[model samples]
Target: MNKEYTVTDDEVGTRLDVFLSNQPDNPSRSSIQKMITDGAVSVNGQTKRANYKLRLSDNIVMTYQPLQEIEVQPENIPLDILYEDKDIIVINKARGMMVHPATGVYTGTLVNALLYHCHGELSGINGKIRPGIVHRLDKDTSGVMVVAKNDFAHNSLAEQIGSKTAIKEYVALVHGNITEEKGIINANIGRHPVDRKKMAVVTSGGKSATTVFHVLERFKNCTYVKCRLLTGRTHQIRVHMAYIGHPLIGDPKYCNSKNKFNIEGQALHSLNLTLNHPRTNQQMTFTAPIPQDMQNLLNYFRQTI
Candidate 1:
């Protein structure tokens, strides 16, 4: 394919690859660099490096071949399906299940299973890599999630979540003694300045995040709580809880405490999800049973107390 772009005054001084990345349906930056290196991209009819800076009214032409599609293979992994219809599928996802494939993880994910089950019925708006995935739960956060079967459902669900009309509730066991029955942790979350991989509660240069938590039970040292997110920032619950001196029992990124409970991952689970049906506009709620690990831990705490 071939296209021509005339640089505008507002876009001056941007790198060649950066400019291409902003284009709709453009290839990855690395791919753009490759195209530039192969003389596929020319500025004013002359080839230039990927780092070439744009100038006002500069005429640029680019030619490239689309990368071949590599389909994600479907796996016959059994899913704990909660509800299924032509429009959506609700599942009680297990802990350790990646919602979609990531770098170096191409199989054994929820996407692969969804591919097999839905059989090409998944929505294509997110592309092949993340077909049907509406929102995601972290790998260790097991619980209720919905997958879209078509584009209409996908758009509706995405809008509801973005507008804060969709309600998602969670259960977690954290290390703390809560005197208050209910509380709200409102903070801004951003990437940790030191550790790029972890999210943190930052005072500035962060997105506003809020978590409303209700104390369900208090152990001698630990507490069981229910949390509802008012804003869906990355690791919002974990970061906010740790900021308030309570971290999920097995959270690897935020908490640095001992794992005496023998929990495999963070003691957090998506307990409830409520949203309106995309087609009927009727309210619907889905629930997932707590994983046995967390349930057993709670039972033991209650029995011993």
Candidate 2:
């Protein structure tokens, strides 16, 4: 099916891709740019560059289709629902639960559980495989997460996060006691030059990343710290901590230390998140308690040893 739109006087001077991006249920702006380059978009029966400014009364046609929608089967898995409403649902996701199905793995994920729990009423912008997932926690990271029940809520939440109006904080047990009580790590992060599976702080060709960390408790060897992400990058906390030579204890991907604690995966957890409600425009903060495994590790460090 084709979609057509005529630029109105109020929309004049907007870029072609920008105009399309503002339309309902459109893919990302980058994807829209690609479509324009690929000749899937035309203005007045002729292709135009993505940045071409709009003209009033221009008849625009789009021949591109959105990504195919594949509905994932819902499961009987339970969810730790922290908050729920007609617009959104917040979850205290457990460690070891993947947020959504990926290649070769399709079950036992947050989406599978959400499909059942939300009664298949999740937002479709992210497609059915990740319906309602506004953001994600690593499979081993337990914490508070927000989900959208509809496209309107999804756009609002995504904008809040992307604009940094939403704040994310985490707690982690690192290998060594950070000497400074508080400090900031500012660096560029990108894919590892060699490993490709890991992220590293690079001097070039990387996205700017910043993390503010405060020492919470000092143990014999390890330190418990609170980290606030100023800029969200993939594995920002883990990579920044590792770059500073205090990789998180039990972090399989970033830490090369011995598994001194019986904790599973990383000793990192999302502690708090602050954002505005899409419908009410009211600010809200949600907290997820530290998982038992990470807490037990802390207690063990405090006692006897």
Candidate 3:
């Protein structure tokens, strides 16, 4: 189906791709750009680049092609469930586990396990692929996460996180010894202009992000620190830590190859999470013990230091 939109006066000067992404249809910018380049999108009856500037009253037409949804199946994967109730379930997500299914990854995700455990009672607000998922932990970052069982609970929990009322804390071992006892990184984050796959501390056209860290222990060349996120931007902690020159140990994406530790992934863990109960409105906190790999690395550091 082809859809048409007239650029409003207020929408003038916006990039063609940006305007399309902000629409209610919510297509990803990459998809929109791809469509534009393929001539699936046209402005003023002519094909335009994704970065073409829009003007008032410009007529834009887009071809709307729905993506084929992949079916997610239930899997009997074991879960370290911390807490469960009528409305929510909290889990200590393991490392190397994805929170939800993506293209080319349909099984062995947290969602697949939730589907089996919840028995189709999980909330569908996030659609089929992310049923009951309220928040996410990166695949390599093991930690605590809460899932909503119903729509009401999902809305409540999402509100708490979006409003910054929910608190999330992490423990990480970084490459360099942090000199400061405690510090805050207040920077704007955006997709890296050169490497679109990575996030960076951007100076312009970025969203505000803040992370506070306190040094827990310092080794000869590494520091164990606790970090609290004030904003939930993608890779916020990793980007902020790397920006400050103390990338997390074993962080393959952000850190250089100078890491001496033979670890599979970043030495970061979601140590604690605090939020209000959706049903009772009572404050609740959950903590997950550090994974064995991180602990072993820490022990090695201790012996060496």
| Number of the top-ranking candidate, with TM-score as the measure | 3
Cα deviation at 161, candidate 3, in Å, is 0.3
Worst 10 residues of 2 by lDDT: 63-72
What's the C-alpha lDDT at position 144 in model 1? 100
Question: Which of candidates 1 and 2 reaches a greater TM-score?
Answer: 1
- Pairs that collide in candidate 1 are none
> In model 3, what lDDT does residue 126 have?
89
Backbone clashes in each candidate structure, one number apiece? 0, 0, 0
Residue 112 of model 1 has an lDDT of 96
CA lDDT of every candidate:
0.89, 0.89, 0.89
- State in Å the error of residue 273, model 1: 0.4
lDDT of 2: 0.89
Instruction: Kindly list the per-residue Cα lDDT of model 2 for residues 55-174, writing each as its tens digit.
Output: 989999998543344457899998998899999999999999999975335689999999988889989998767899889998899999999999999999999999989999999999
Candidate 1 wrong stretches, greater than 4 Å: 1-70
